[model samples]
Target chain A: MNEIMSILSYTFFQRALLCGIAISFSAALIGVILTLKNYSMIGHGLGEVGFAAIALALALNLPTYAVSIPIVIIAAIAIMIISQKKGEGADLIIALVASGALALGVIITAFTSGFGTDAYNYMFGSILTIGSADVILSIALTVISVGTYAFFYNRLFLVTFDESYAKARGIRVTLYQFLIALITALVVVIGMRMMGTLLISSLIIFPAIIAKRHTNSFKGMVFTSVFVSIACFIIGMFSAYFLNLPTGAGIVLIYMILSALSLATTKLLKL
Target chain B: MSLLEIKKLNVSYSNHYALEDIDLKIDEGEYVCLVGENGSGKSTLVKTIVGLKKQDSGTINLNIELGKVSYLAQFNLKDLNFPATAKEIIMTGTQKHGKLPFYSKKDKEVYKRVIEQLHIEDLQNRRIGDLSGGQKQRVLIARALISEPELLILDEPTAGLDYNITQEFYKILKQLNKENKLTIIMATHDIEELANDKPRIVYLSKKVVYDGNYDGWKGYEK
Candidate 1:
């Protein structure tokens, strides 16, 4: 018991606990917006882009997040630009570009000497190594993301419902779309540290999907998603601790289970 | 001077032309109805005018400028189950440009005026997702009008309403047009509704087949 208590008292575990909760809250709120707008894959696309840029940064041995910032931004901008006038087919282009980048990164990392074991931590996040700097970065991102969402809440709502209607009323739909993409990219970057490239989107999607079933309004959806995400993060982290399992997989599995339960409850209640 | 002028307008998807060589002019405060078969480009024209769809090759010279023309699509782009009140939907019109944390008092006043003007005061608090088809149409129209646009464009405004509701809607539109001096352009399937409001009519079937007054539509008998 003393050993377990001491482990929890360690700075690494404290950083992981704090950053994990904040990341899940921010990601889940944004996720509701993405899910409602049917842009669930945006997070996935961003995760792939983040992984590629991180791999490139590792090869160059640069500050990983700083080096990857421009790449993720470019990927996000490309996704928005390509999808502007096109239909669902644009999603295909986004997926292709993102997957190609990730695959390229994987190949590069595989060929590199030092990137062998280090790359696995990124592929599947290792929350055990979370540092104070990562925690500070996550806190900053959470503040920015949450603040921006609150500021543009109504306009975002209008754009989500109908871009044309929003434009007709002079909402600057393109500008808002660009801003959202940027923020989503930033969230993905931060979340990648805790959840990793493969599991980050689950942090965004599952909480949102479950909250959507239980909520009636956009505001309700946001609150519900944040709550679900925070709860899942705590439970998944503790469960991973007890079972000596991978934290990312544990969190995602718990999210999936919760989502399924939510769906079933909605059905039972005829919602 | 014409409120709107289109010269040699052509619309297409990929290679298939939807409208061809369409030249038309709308005067200020003129109520115009576009009657056309499906895919004949009635909705396409309105969409182009409102900047929703780009013209493949043509010029839309609006004396009123682009954003001053408000447009309502054939159907609400939002899902029917979306949780927004009628007032909130209508507010989207007036508050479009006034994004978060910057909503001015003047914008609220504009919304209040529009609510009063549209006579939807009673229905303001009702959830738009729960409204009937006719009511939804009215709410959307009210939203378009909230901006006080120089030109109001509606695509198939009464497409899904009951016969009686459609008639009543046309009457309301006629009254609103007269009272507000709103320049109204709409694509409608109900040719009979044109009889009550004697607006200028354009008959189309993949082209501008006819353009004249409602009573003098010579392309087809109503």
Candidate 2:
């Protein structure tokens, strides 16, 4: 308890904790919709795209998340449109874009001298470096995410549940699709800054899936996922502080442990 | 009164046309059984009527309010396991009434009335996957009927049901058509089974091949 308090005495630690909770909430919320819609990999897919966006931002000496958000959001919506046209082979489209973007980022990294080390920071993340700017952005994100969700919650439920039926009722299915993709892109970009491109998708994938095992309804799953995500983030941050571990890796490890335990409990109890 | 009129409608995908030069008209309180074979355009026609798919080149004239046309899509194998409950699913039907969440007094009334009307108050909280085939169909039908639509469009609604359940479902549709005076356009591959219901058949195979009552459809061929 003393150690955690000491860690919190530092402003950087305070920023990291605050930012992490905000990101986790939005990540889990978007995660439920993505997982239910079978778009889980879109997180990882956007992560790879974010990598290329970061590289481009670095090349132009611009702000990373700022540049990454628009590029990733566009890619997210484009992927959705292509998937709609291509039908159920969305996995293939996501794989194609992700691989292509990762390759492009890698090429840029190879060409830029003395930049590989900085890129490495983004790959694994350095959450201890969280600044006031990041904290402010995260808080803003939380407000936007919650507001967007509240405004469109019913329409989103209809689109996610029965898109064709929703469309037939004169609901704008395409517009909702765009809104989900847009929010997903925002969360992925912001999360990548704190958790890195490689591990951020896990934040979006694990909480909803874990919550799914425990909850029965969509609303239940959403609330449970947010709870699980925030809990995991705080615990994982504490462990990282105490054990001298990387925050991203520690959080993901905690997620894995929770997932295994959930599987085991469900199997044994037959619940 | 004509509820829907499709004039020279044509819908096509990449390689070939799914529906072509289709012309049809539906009147109020009519029960239309759209029968077709595999790869035929029964699903396509219904989707077009509901405006889910844009016609390549044609006109679709809907005399009724757009919200008055409810579409109950074919039951998906994947969606059966989805996490929505019967009550929640039924509430989604209220989406056409407005986009915001159900906060109005009238919205609650519609929801309560639909469940009571369907006699599905018992299945309200049950997961959709837990319901029997007939019960699932019942819930889906309730969803479509919740908006008090003037016309209901169902795509292969009885695809996976047992014979008895299918008969019971047809009886329900018959009741809706006769009592509520609701117009219906149900797409199905089970022509032989539907023959017993004796609805006005519009046999479609990329185009309208036949449009007549069961008596006139006695010896119709592809």
Candidate 3:
């Protein structure tokens, strides 16, 4: 407890906690919405786009956040357009886009060679990388995520449950679809820095799945996912600090354990 | 005044016409049953009326400016695994037009009226996945009706139900149409079943093959 309190007293550790919680909360909300639509791969795909955007920003000597955000948004909209076809076409488009963006990032990184930090740091995530600015951005994203969700909760529900019904009711299905894609892109870009592009999507996927195992209602799923995400992030950070594990790895480990436990609990409760 | 009118409408997918030069007009408080074989565009016509798909060329004038529509899509069209209580699902229908954060008091009252009308008040809090197939359909109908739509459109609402249940379902629709003066448009391929119900049947095979009296339409079918 004394050691842990010392870690919390550090400004860097505090920043990581603030950033992680905010990103995880938004990621979980976005995850539940996308998972309902069977578009979970969207998070992974957006992460790849985010990586490429950041690499490009580094190459151009521009601000990473400004450059990465717009590029990811554009890519997200493109994915939305391609995914409008749905089924095999949608899956193929996401796969193609994800692979292409990842390849582009790798190629860009090789040419620039000016990224000051090790690419390994971005790949696996290092809590030491989060700055005060990142903390602010993450908090802003949380506010945006919560506000967007609160205002559009019904429309999002209607769209996710029965899109045709939403369309027939005169709701702007395409607009809301774009809004979902846009917000998801924002979450992916911010999350990629802390959780790594390779693993950030897990932050979106795990919480929602874990929450689903524990609850049977959509609202319950959303709240549970948010709770699971924040709690896991905090515990994982602490575990990583104490046990000498990677932060993302520790968080994911905790998520995996809870997932298995929830599955078992659901079965035992039913029995 | 007719609640809906479609003139010279043509819709195509991949160079094949789903609906070709379609002409349709539905009136206030009238019940319309659209019948066609599979791929004959019964679903296409309903989709166009509800504005899901835009017409390639021609016009659809939905008469109601407010034009509130309650749509119960086919069973296969809805994602039943969606984790929402029956009440939450129903309440979302009323929240689309600027009612935000949560359902309002007026929304709650509308919900009460719909559930009382549908008599599925008990299923309100039950998870969607837990409801029986017939019960799911009832909840969907309640969701649609809670909006107090000027027109109610359904595509194969009776699919996957037993014969007795289908009849009972239609009986409720009939009562709503007769008593509440609600406009209804339903599309089904169940020729033998719905033809006996004697609603105005518009038979379509990519176009209006027959319109008006089902009695005369039977001769036309022969």
Candidate 4:
């Protein structure tokens, strides 16, 4: 109990809690849409691009989020464009891009002699390392994300369900598609600080899948996903502080356990 | 004035022409059925009209307001697993009604009317994926109708339905056309079943072979 109180008193722990909650909520909102559209893998692919950007930023002594965010946005748009072209396999294209970015990141890290500690921190994530700048940026982005989602909720629902019909109804399908990709890219980049590049995409995938197993409506799925993500993040952070486990892996393992329980319960109930 | 006009329209799929020199005009409240064999471009023509497919060289003049058009795509079994309720799916149709981020009171009224019109009140709260094929088709039709579109385009809406369900489906469409005067342009292969309506039939095999009453299509040959 004393240890818990002392941990909570630290500014780093408070920042991690705030950032983790915000990121998890933002990721849940974007994740439900992507998972339903069958574009969940794009999160993983864009995370790789963010990883490359972060490595490059570190090697050049530049601000990490400043460099990584813009590059991830560009890569996200590129993926959307490439996927939109007919007759081209979107999954294959995403795979090639993801692998290429991972290799680039690895090669850059190799050249930087003193990159071991920074690279390790990025790959596994350290909640104690989150700075005030990250906290402010994360909170601002979360607000924008929530606002965009609220304003475009109906239109996004239409596009996700029947894009062709949405187009016929004059919904500007392309614009909304790019908007979703952009929002997802932003969330993935900001989230990489605490979740790590290796497992960040899981935050986007697990919550949606677990909620989908329980909810039948789009609104229900989204609400359930956000709730599940926030709960998992808080519990994972606390468990990591007490158990001395890596924060990212701790959160992801909790997500896995929750997802397994959700799956089993859904099957038992025949839902 | 015609509600929709397409002139000199051409659509191709990688150097192979799917439709060429297609000219079509549909007036308000007209019931037009497009019939053709597989690869005859029946689907292509409807898709082009709905703005899902770009025309190679032509003009598609929609006389009505832009949002006054609605489409019901062909059913694919893969979409059966979509996590949405019938009511939620139907509510999406109201997106064309206004610029608001959410549905208004009027939108909700229209939704209620659509549910009653389609006799899908029981399925309103049911998950779409859990509904039967016939029930799902009615939900989709409701989605298309809730927009109150002057022109409703359907691409093989009854493709995989059973015989009785197909009959029921046609009945609802006929009621909408005759009673509500909703202009409907449908593409389907069920010519004999649709013979009772005496709808204008456009038979195509890469081009319009016949564009007249259904009885006239019997003599049409590619």
Best by TM-score: 4
lDDT of 4 by residue, A6-27 (tens): 9889999999999999889999
Off by over 4 Å in 4: A86-89, B77-79, B95-101, B219-222
Ranking of candidates on lDDT, top first: 4, 2, 3, 1
What is the DockQ for all candidates, taken in turn?
0.39, 0.56, 0.62, 0.59
lDDT of model 3 at residue A25? 92
1 against 2, candidate with superior TM-score: 2
Which residue pairs in model 1 clash with each other? none
Question: What is the alpha-carbon lDDT for the whole of candidate 2?
Answer: 0.84
Sort the predicted structures by DockQ, highest score first. Answer: 3, 4, 2, 1
Best by lDDT: 4
Candidate 1 total steric clashes: 0
The residue-by-residue lDDT of candidate 4 on B57-98, one tens digit each, is 989999988677889987664656577999988888874433
In angstroms, give how far residue A126 of model 2 lies from its true place.
1.3
For residues B37-110, write the lDDT of model 3, one tens digit per residue: 89999998888777787779989888886447778877663555568898887887784443354766787898
lDDT per residue as tens, model 2, A1-271: 7877788898888889899999999998889899988898999989999998898888778888778989999999999999987685677888999999999888877776335656876777777657888888888888877876788887888788877777778787888888889888988887776787888889999999899887657778889999999999999988877787778888998999999998899899985
Which scores greater on TM-score, model 2 or model 3? 3
In terms of lDDT, model 4 sits at: 0.86
Question: Which numbered prediction scores highest in DockQ against the true structure?
Answer: 3
Every candidate's lDDT: 0.80, 0.84, 0.84, 0.86
Residue B54 CA displacement from its true place in model 2, Å: 2.1
